[model samples]
Target: MTIQAAFTLIINTLGPLQGNREAANIAHIVIEHITGMGRMDRVIYKDKLLSPAQEEQLQQALNALLKHEPVQYVTGKAWFYGLEFTVNRNVLIPRPETEELVEWIVKDTHTPVKILDIGTGSGAIPIALKKDLPAATVWSVDVSAGALEVASQNATQLNLNVHFEQIDILDTTATHSLPLFDIIVSNPPYICESEQKDMEEQVIAYEPRIALFVPDNDALLFYRQIGLLAKEKLVPGGLLYFEINEAFGKEVVALLEKQGFKNVILKQDLYTKDRMVRGEN
Candidate 1:
């Protein structure tokens, strides 16, 4: 079948599940993954047709999408901070708001400094930060080995030198011996368990649960834990950054302030949701 024909079939099938805009976007991404052709290339080859093998692959991706699997997972890659990173069911797909957090970190790099990214799935935070601020020493930690594997692979593919370690942030006694940092950042799981029922089925069902949830009553768990760690592991005046849940921006800022972090600031995303927070120890 022609590429155009296959694209129409897939888009028509999945389009209604999410929306026309998302379906069209996913269709383009799937075609690019299977044929390695961008929008222009797809247009150029519209009449050229997809081979049988390519058609089969496209059908499989469509099935996954119809089941509410994220297009990023369907394509095995997602773009963050304008860079591509590998993603799977094990890691949370990097989002645009996280890019703002990376921007916040890079902007503060007036000099070479030690940096740490907590819950660094896909190593997106550290990799993007390092790509822009090459002089900084960057390290990332995650409790899941599978997540760390994806993060490490992303670092290698991007040729960004970042140290990935498998360690839980809540296990403070062990992390206490780790080296100090000039900037500690995280896009930690701030979603409360009760919120899961309200999330899109694709997200709640397909994305890694451990990477997306905290106790229903303790939504600020990671922020509080990481905030304390920043106090202990960061130099005096060190910076702390977080990609927080929009609903808890005020609470997160308060958590940092209660821990004595100064200059606590909450920044919004392109949509004007309070999504990023920064403070100094």
Candidate 2:
């Protein structure tokens, strides 16, 4: 099949399921990943025929897309903070809001300081921070071995020298072993179980639940635990940053304040919804 034929097949197959714009996006992502054809190349070589192996790959990708898997997961790649990352079912795909959270850290932080990332789902946060703040030392921890494996590979591939370890942030004993840090950031599990009904089908079905959902009753579980940990592990003026659920902006600010963190601020993302919160120890 020609390149245009393949594109049409994918777009037509997914249009009804995901809508026209999204279907076009998925087609572009899968085609570029498999054939390495950029937008111009796709247009320039619209008549170029796909080789047998390429056709097979496209077929497989189309099958997955039909199931409503995210294009990032289907491609095994995602872009975050201008860096490309390897993603899988084991790791959550990095989101634009999370990138905003990272940018906030880049702006507020100036000195080279030790940083700890509570959940290392694709190593996107720490790796991007390390790239922007090249002098800073970064360590990231996660409870899932599979997620750590993916994160470690990303760190090695990017040559960023990030420390990836399997540490459950929920475990006080394990967390105590971590050294003090000047900045601690997390995009931890903030989606409440009760909110699952409202989330996208692809996210609910394909993304790792352990990295996304919190018990409805204890929606601030990670913020509370990580905040307390920060109190113990952060330096006198160290900062704690979190990508939070918009619904709990005031609640998170309050939790940080009650934990004795000062200068607590709830910031919104590009959409102007409360998406990030910062506190100083």
Using lDDT as the measure, which candidate wins? 2
117-177 per-residue lDDT for model 1 (tens digits): 9998888999999999998899999999999999999999999999888888899776976
Off by over 4 Å in 1: none
Model 1, residue 278: displacement in angstroms?
1.3
- Weakest ten-residue segment in model 1 by summed lDDT: 14-23
Clashing residue pairs found in predicted model 1: none
Model 2: per-residue Cα lDDT over 1-281, one tens digit each: 99999999988999998788988988898889988989999999999999999999999998888787898998899999999999999999998989999899999988899999989899999999999999999999999999999999999999998998999899999987799999999999999998988888999999999999999889999999999999999999999999999999999999999999999999999999999999999
Q: Model 2, residue 267: displacement in angstroms? A: 0.1
Model 2 scores worst on lDDT over the 10 consecutive residues at 62-71
Task: Please give the CA lDDT of all the candidate structures.
Answer: 0.89, 0.94
Which candidate leads the pack in TM-score? 2
